[model samples]
Target: MNFLWSLFMRKPALRQFALLDAQGRCQAFKECNQPPVGNGWVEIDEIRLSWMHRPLPARARVSPRPAQSSRHQPLAA
Candidate 1:
């Protein structure tokens, strides 16, 4: 059982890679099973992993104003 499982279930699926242009747009996609074509391609999975490690920019914080009373005395009619 162990031998059969190792032979079949141990293998992982083919990895998918995205080909990007100079503008960082995806032009095409290719899997690991396919032969390499042109350059400027990156692994789709790596993109998400890299983004998770990136730091976010600081944003300016705004202070809230004090509350004002809206009640007013009635005027003579």
Candidate 2:
């Protein structure tokens, strides 16, 4: 006998939505905002999202530059 539980089941994945203009540029997100009245626009109803998490192992170290000989030079008017 097999018993199924809701806690062990995976949740349904949701889709993202976006509005694009005539030049294929993103104008609005979540499909909640109203688009312009007279222009060629496209609606993406089922936009999938990809997420990732990556941590860098090490960071680069930068050293300061040495002082130039202009330290003792006088200022000109």
Candidate 3:
């Protein structure tokens, strides 16, 4: 069905995996480069994920301030 296909492809609805850390708390993720902790998929009681990645610092907007003013003349020997 087209509805089913859409759900499967939808990144928000599709959970790549969940992992339990040593602290016993479970973390939900959209994806992971490494294998999940349990090595299997299981029904989760709760899930949380941020759909958007934290925006990276844009080079265009960020301009570093000049460390020192050029008005000071250098010492002569």
Best by TM-score: 1
- Top candidate by lDDT: 1
The estimated TM-scores of all candidates read 0.38, 0.27, 0.23
In candidate 3, the residue pairs with backbone N, CA or C atoms under 3 Å apart (3 or more residues apart, or in different chains) clash, namely none
Better of 1 and 2 by lDDT: 1
TM-score of decoy 2: 0.27
Clashing pairs in 2: none
- Superposed Cα deviation of residue 50, candidate 2 (Å): 16
lDDT of 1 by residue, 1-77 (tens): 99988888756567656666666655565668443577865555422333332331112111333555598656886
Q: List the candidates ranked by TM-score, beginning with the highest.
A: 1, 2, 3
Those runs of model 2 whose alpha carbons end farther than 4 Å from true positions after fitting are: 1-5, 31-77
lDDT of 3 by residue, 1-77 (tens): 99889788945443244444444334434354333455423333233453123222222122423456669867995
Model 2 per-residue lDDT tens digits across residues 9-42: 7766443344445544455445334433545333
Q: Which rank order by lDDT, best down to worst?
A: 1, 3, 2
Off by over 4 Å in 1: 1-12, 33-37, 46-77
